[model samples]
Target: MNTQSLTKKWSKTICLAFLYSLSIFSNCYSKGNRIQSSDLKDSLISLLKKSGNDTLMIDSVYAHIRINRRRLGEEYKNTLLEYIDYTTKIQYSRGAMRMYDRLGLNERYDERYDSAVYYHLKSLELALELKDSFQMAYNYNNIGQAYRLQDINNLAIKNFHKALELQEANGNDKGASFTQNTLGAVYVVQKEYDQAMHYFRESQKIAVRRKDQRTQSYNLGAIGEVFLLRDQPDSAIVYFNTAKDIKQQMGDKKGLAVSKHLVGQAYFKKGNYVEAQKFLNEALVIHQKYNNERYIALCFDYLGKVKLKQNQFSEAGAYLLKAKEIASNIHSYENLISINNSLKEYYQEMDKWPMAMLAIQQNQQINDSLFSLKKTREMQALEIEYETEKQEQQIKLLSAENEIKEQRLKIGIAIITLLVLTIAFGIFIQKEKQKRFVLERDKVKQQLLRSQMNPHFLFNALGSIQSYMYQNDVKTAARYMGNFASLTRSILNNSAVEQVSLEEEISTLTNYLELEKMRLQSNFQYSIKVPEEMDIEFITVPPMLIQPFVENAIKHGIKNYTSGGKVELTFEETSDLIHVIIEDNGEGIDTTRGKMVSSHKSMATSIFKQRMKIIRDKFPNVPEPVIADLSDVNRKGTRIDLYLPILELTSTSNA
Candidate 1:
């Protein structure tokens, strides 16, 4: 049972609206019971009508609904729906987005999970329209939580990852922390304790760093839950008490209630009947007051177990029936499972063999259904992994064939050049020239291989996939496999070429950066930009020229970043040269390479310099790359401007 509430954050605008609503709706807010739903609705409509298309005023009224959501209860949802309609009519996108999100969360609380997902998607669409990455991530997280509550593991994981990706890329540490906990909760449902703990600890670290007390409490409680699940009641009690203390200090009534319920469960597990009853009763009162059916059901179920342990058969039956009724009404399968088990035990105690058998069958059916769901998830994971491995093998075979063909072509060219030179010049002259040509070709080949597909990169990339699989993150492994394979294919395809179209080069670089992002766990953001008017398809540059610089930016520049790492590649052109500017908002060259000198540190750069020397021999006018530390006064990063001859392929050349 997920006792912890999903964390939510509002914009500064919402805080302002909260203040604004105090003056406008003070009576309705302070004396909620005295105000009827129809009166509240009319008052809200009057406020909206007065506000017209004024988004700020409309948002304030929306904020009022959110602030009084619990007090208004069912009426609050009516207010949100009306708010959404008003905002939609006026094309107030921001207000509409928030309304939909609030409505979705309300639906989730009411256990209308599919409706929750639908509203969150609606919110996401508006978030996208407004180009608000934070809001988009928020909606994605909300959708994931809804799915997770319904035990839809696959969709839940997909949405949670999407939220995490956006949050990390945007350096939204708070959002990332919240998403991490949600992901942990999913693994907990699946009984993947190790993975669950991994995520919970990650979230804890972020909460600690941010000094976020609420999040810290949530993490502590979650850790307690794991201990409870492992049958370590004493350890669970310690954590739950800590969480309860924190929430009490914060005066968080709702959070404190959940913490009390967890503590009660731990006490029951420890056979402390009096303390368990005291805490569970307290939790049940608060849950009833708040109309939180899920936690109420949980409280009742656990209370029944405690009473059953105390040999109060009649009382146990009463509590279990209450739990069953609520669990059934809310469609809480996990809670129903517990209630059914409790009912079975109670029936057996009463010597009702027929009733006991019915409860046993019901319990078994629920367990079987949950087991089948888990099995389906496992089978899907295996299928994805199998397909990924199959693709990897195919790519390897293709790469091997390409290598053999390349070697044979190189031999044929060498032979042809030897014959032509021997006929044109003296044998001695041919031998000297051939020796120099062979040495240069070998040097270029070695440098190209280092820059194109470094062994370390291949090893690390494959290792990342292996780690994901071992962690049972099959989706991530499959995604990594696809990117790795595409990057490998691009490297092999481009290796034989002297030059490639800028479009093709950019595509390869995108795959490389995407893989790096996944491998590094989205600690950084990257962008590739070209002028809208520029014709990249017709423009060619030396293969692997820009990649080394981009690699350096990632490996040495931003490798150690927790967040806010940025790499940008922009393409521009003059009459003679195409300029590829690679920039990173990371440690400058001096701090990165000079302070931490290593052989691998500048290997790509050194190889790229040598490669550039070779390219300059063919295009004599090409300029050497310019390296600059972007650390004048305000910012610190490395910028490298690589100049290349604008090589364009003619129609005949293409043929």
Candidate 2:
């Protein structure tokens, strides 16, 4: 299926889950057990307190919250926030993970897939730290669902497989079945019906063996969808009816509604307009009761088609118009396209050529928008994958270095032990060897720092210049080339030195930022401020130490904005340190981070951190850089304060 169609289907799938949760709540509360509205807040607070320091209690509380979420509505969010805060305060990692997962689910319902993924990843990290395989599998499934909603099928499949592996390993058959069903759904969207059926059947077998009615109902509906996709309407109806029966037995009103809709669709395909309309209308009532706009629109479209087939032209037009209005209000392009296509048919049958033409035009516009959205998501996914891989490679490199260091340390200890026994005989020789080893290590460290100015930047800058040249923008290309050349020269000149004058560092940063601004079509503004009392020429700092943060602020933060992007660099001298602060008025770090698929530890940032480690080792009195999210301070950006020892350059050549 195309992205727009898949998106519409995904929305309904999410709504189904929402409704299922509601049903769970209803089942729990039906026997005069419902919490009164006035006691709801106090009840939740009591649950939180009772959950203190107890994982099982926390789990029970989370279950209650999940089931009651719909009834709690907007209040559910505040309750979750309070629960998260309490868990965090008590250092309850498991509780915090559960709450984060719930929060992510809430975000997903709001169609904020990026934010949902972020919270899921946070929960995943905690799961990893706690070595909780069940939570890990659950989080992986959640992340897959988020990616699936975005139409990022490859990533969604990857995460689903990860979840499936862990679930099976942990002997969580029910969890495994759930993940299998999710994987099948993704394959269905990809039009791999055969593969989808295989997964659906596997899930169904597991669900039947486990006596998991909920899972069985889900798998049955999925199997029906596969038949529907293959144009086997009779086969689809059989499965849909079975699913509907199971849902009714389980008192799953939401699942029953979904199955009814699918069954109605199959009936329509079989040309049983009267039967299709009956089921579709029934599903429509449930959807309207739940305020599920996507399903409401879907039912309207289906009902219109049934009416059209029955030759009820006026009724068909009315239903189609209703669907169109809902689709427009919700910005559901797929539904709008379907409604318009139905409108076109209605107009053509009525001999209204102008109305049919207008419908076709509107349909084409929606298709174009969907195509553009697909391209944008593809590009973002590619960028995220590339960055994640790069960071993984850097991490592997660091791990290898650490292993080598450990081996070296062991060897040194052994050598020292041996030498101690022969100290009188080899003291002078040992001292000379130790001195040489220190010198070589320091030399290697300096070389590593020099190599840290990644070649990727130079290549990308050159590529941009080439792009501008090819566009025949001679003046703009020339200016970009000049800045690139100047930045390149400054980097090469400073790479050999331990430090550079503050003035030289700032100048290089200025050149680099200017080129980036031009490359980004002047989307951002920047400033460098040095205290009047401080001598920029005399003070020296580690070469390229501050550039990474500045680069991050621009690329990840400001790049999201079309205009009003601002970055400020300020230098202040304390008695023992030079404070260099880089701040940006852009989307805060959290928003920028949500766009990333994985938390890629940046190579530049890693190198800077290593450099800081070296400084802390060599000059014990110097403080390290303090990176802060300005949002924590009630501001609107990121701030990095680098505290450097006020080292003066010996000469201009050294700088």
Candidate 3:
């Protein structure tokens, strides 16, 4: 497949892209409707099965392949790129090209239009070199698919025509038919309904002409898709049924699954929950059977809708979750957006405004990103064409003289690959940041949660006090009720501050400990190693973050200790952090299994750990509280070290 020329040409293109970062179209085509076939099915399957020796390579391949091929069949599409990477490194051009093509499809599925176009163009280059016109046409068709996904109809129409021409020229009837179908989609996107229907009819004719059941199924599905777009659910159902019959006859589970999904959607649109659920369930089984994850995700979403209508709240929630995972993993942006919106709706139904808002944000983010990408693709086109004007022209002249070298397309394809790779990298970083931000926000909520105490627990405490009062034990009941009132006051005070002043926080802890002391008189003693003149107020920490550890010390360690039951609290403030030390001379923790805690013995200790986890996740730089057994082997004692970064503030009042 001219490995040397391919590498050289690809490298040349990359070098130009790094400096320019633009995109160019080597050729254009008019839109056409074509039927789908199983031409690339074997190639997809073969690539999916390739597990390179390197696990990372396997992962990369799986990710890329999973991106594209997982929709067609139950095969792992994500792993395709990894295999292609290994194959390319090992100089397996055939496998590399297949992987490259798969990568483009992955990007296309991801709604990364520029990237998909770039990669597919490269695939086209390799296919043309290999003299595999069918493969080249496949690439063109995929590129058109990418554009179609982006709603770039002019370009989609153009690339679809290129594929159609190549397929027809090479007598690749199936390729031609499918390419024609895609063109119809572009027309639909452009709202040229007549042209769209014309292409669909043309695609159907080709499918029947070729007597290919697979193509016929896809043609029917394509018609259904258009009908669904027109909100003609009844008409869509008829076409979907036709597709289903053809797919079932051919034993093409994936095709049958999508058909059923369409039928489900049709029923869903007609407000027929029972029929929708039935068809959607059938679709789900078929999708899972064929490993058609994309369709499976779709079915999950529709199932959730059905469950929601049936008032099966838990079932609806479960299905939505599965839908989110599949849609996100598959890079089905539209599907992801839909799934997220559905999740938002579910949360809204539950009256969870915060969760609903969060889900809505996620859904909006996908839409925002797609919109941004569409804008970037436009800018990139101008940049690529302008920067590579000279080299591109030179390649054009050469291609005109000898059609044997479609180097321009190769170069554009290389550029597309680079663009997709870069965008993937950026998205990864953005996603991580988003995760961190969400974690931080939740930590803030956790820090504030105590203000809203559980009424039942409050009831129990008050009831205990009331029993004492009813028995004329006024002193004991008064002491217990006073402690409860103090705890409530601290909760209120803590709720008002985003972060706690070290001095005020320590005072709050002292109040809580004193109350516990009243409950278990003389069982424990505690002291804070705070300097009399130290400005503890200047050091801000997560509210109650340190208090939990101290509480754990009392409930587990000091309470059990027969002697030397003392809890020591110390604070050390430095330039960057405020370190808090909570050590008790009673009941050391079990060091086995990494400083294990018995939540059964002390729920306070367990809650402390959970709260700390939330803090660490929010403030990544804030270290986890370190636990150690500083006491002797048989001694009842444990020490915990917590390091909270100091808020960069000057005055205590400002905090």
- Candidate number with greatest TM-score: 2
Candidate 2 wrongly placed segments (more than 4 Å): 1-103, 285-292, 387-655
Q: What digit string (tens of lDDT, one per residue) describes model 1 on residues 591-638?
A: 353322333546666766677788777666677677777885467988
Q: What is the model-wide C-alpha lDDT for candidate 1?
A: 0.73
The alpha-carbon lDDT assigned to residue 328 of candidate 3 equals 83
Kindly list the per-residue Cα lDDT of model 3 for residues 1-655, writing each as its tens digit.
5756654554444334322211111101112211122322343334335434434323323332322342334333434544665666765566667667777766765667677767776666666556565566677677666656655566667667866777666565556666777677677767787788887888888768756555567668878878888889999999999889977765556667778878989999989999999988987887787788888888899899888888898999999999999888889988888888788889988998999999888877878998898788777655644543453354332222134245446768999998997787986677576334221000101122352345644676666665665565655665565456445533532343456556556656666666555555457667777754344634566666676676668777777665457888888754346778888887576666565454443444566667667766655556666788866556557888888755433220100
C-alpha lDDT (0 to 100) for residue 218 of candidate 2: 84
TM-score list, all predictions: 0.43, 0.49, 0.41
RMSD per prediction, one decimal? 26.0, 29.7, 29.2
Q: Is candidate 2 or candidate 3 better by TM-score?
A: 2
lDDT of each residue in 1-655, candidate 2, tens digit only: 8766754554454344334334534543455545453355556667468556866446545544653565566688788888888888998888888788878878887889888887877777676666666677777788788788888888888778877877676666656777888889889988999989998999988878866666788888899989987889999999999999988865567778999999999999888988999999999988888898998999999999988888999999999999999999999987888889999999999999999999999988888988998899888778755654574354332222343455567779999988776676576577576334221000001111334446777677767767765675555665565455434433432343576556656666766677777777778878888866455645667767777778888877676788789899998866436788899987566534332111345788777778788887755657656656688878888777777865533321100
Which regions of candidate 3 deviate over 4 angstroms?
A: 1-156, 166-172, 186-194, 325-331, 384-392, 396-655
